[model samples]
Target: MLRRNPIDFFNLIWSDEAVQKISKNTDLITRSKIEQNQENLKPHSRLRKWSSPSKADIRRLMGIVISMGVIRLPSITDYWSSNNVLCIPFFREVISRDKFWNLHVADPLPDNVSYPSKSYKIQWLLDHVNMRSQELYEMGQNIAVDETMVKFKGRIGFRQYNPKKPTKWGMKLFTLADSNTSYMWQQNLYVGADGRETELSKCAQHVLDLVEPLSNLSHTVYADRYFWTLGLAQRLIDSGFNINGTVMPNRKGFPQRLKSAKHMKPGEIIAFRKDDILMLQWKDNRVVTMITNNCRSDEWCTIKPKNPNHDTRNKPKCIADYNKHMNGVDVNDQLCTYYL
Candidate 1:
């Protein structure tokens, strides 16, 4: 091990200047939308602080929002209390609590502008963010795709319920991230419907939509059972990419023998292959099914069990790689929670 300057190896690949440009454009759009609606309302009925939002005003509002995360107060009023304002000089100088509360990113418009069921309110901002992410950095060969949940409890359409998540009730987003750094490269909001298309119609297209830009780059993708299928694996293989992930037992084209078999002992394995696609089931504590197009069937590896009751164990290459690289999105989630 060697001590070195952290700055020497730091790669500031992302451009803060580009993000500022996007934010400036968003401020103009939001201001125009709000003013358009202000004409129809009574003198004081329209948004007081947001009737005309300048770029500087928007920037100040954002600063307050970011500061709130670090302050970690239970309520918004607590942040603006006399005690807090006296102690926190930055917040005291920048903006008032009332202005921060009234901040709005998108415009509420007249009846003419059609609403998008999937992202009616913040679709423009979402699009800009995704575009900025792509421009900031190039992806590596190994990548992982997974669902991320953003907690929001307000009454809104398209709220997801995942019992396993720390925030069970919130928005759902599917993301593609770097396997090594956990940097999110692309993301799509899962709006159940956008007046024309339902979420069901897009579930099968999730993987292709997120990783489409990386096609022909020969990158290997790691995903869970949600997005992996025999047909998808075949499609990715044709596109010159490789994917490895777990497969659901009930997914179509899975061999009937594998599904019907019973009383399999620990470490026993069953496998199926068709052209570039390979499916396997290894009997661990429970039967684990995996699908891949690039892993060797005979490859083996060992993992030290975390449980004191268990010892070291041998696992297939597909399972070992999946465990190692499939945590990109999970790691990103953990990092975000620290500041949240």
Candidate 2:
């Protein structure tokens, strides 16, 4: 008697195990009233003659196909062209490339097998990715949230300008990155400009939701100025998160300096009152007046004179002129200090 190959015998045994597992784990077979269907089928009908593949056979074939595809298909086409004879039926039935590859070579099973939907598979993968990220972050990690844009040619629907790359047309893609490992935590696609209030809020919410699982372990969430808002700040503060960012300018009013009752002592620092006197000397002229917040004083110390005129009596001057000639003058030109 010809000795059967050990590999082939092992495959046969594995296929039997797979089929049994599927039947035992699922209600697809038990819930279906096959007896009624059998009764309905005509005696001569092809359907009445059909027999389901054994559970072991299904599992073995699935494993073989998956192993072969993964190891063999990297060079060219992902399909099993060499094993077309064995895989054609499975390729036609299995919607997932992974399932098709796995089931094609493991065992010779029927082609009518049904599997989960593509959407279901995609959601499962996404959930797995999120879970893995959470595990890593929980071990103490820093997360950074940043936005990007993805562009596609052709007018599929609404078109918008991308702020990051203004010339390109695409929707914003927000991503969370681990500061320590530089691993991407999660990414979200949005159909709007990055700077839009709606888009910014969505990005923030997405980051917050993704990191929610690892919130306790996350050290910090780094974001740009676009995410800096009073409401966003308050929300983070309420959540017991310390925010590190550039302080936004005060929009309400300028800070007030109180008047002191006593005269200024030498080397003593005093809040310069608005009524402090300053002699404004500009080219052959002198105007003495009280310094108000209207005239910025910071510029005087840093302002460079246009030209050192030996005849100090003849210089072209005005408060604005002196400020304009100075480099590094405060852009807002706010009065900085009182000159005695």
TM-score for each candidate, following the candidate numbering: 0.83, 0.34
Clashing pairs in 1: none
Best by TM-score: 1
What C-alpha RMSD separates each model from the true structure?
A: 4.6, 20.7
Worst 10 residues of 1 by lDDT: 6-15
Name model 1 segments beyond 4 Å from true: 1-51, 83-89, 193-201, 305-311
Per residue, candidate 2 scores C-alpha lDDT tens digits across 31-144 of 243344766756765434334445654554455455554444443234434465444444334333433222222222223655332223123334455555545443223355
User: lDDT per prediction?
Assistant: 0.76, 0.40
Per-residue lDDT, model 1, residue 114, is: 73
lDDT of 1: 0.76
Model 2, residue 246: distance off in Å is 4.6
Candidate 2: what lDDT?
A: 0.40
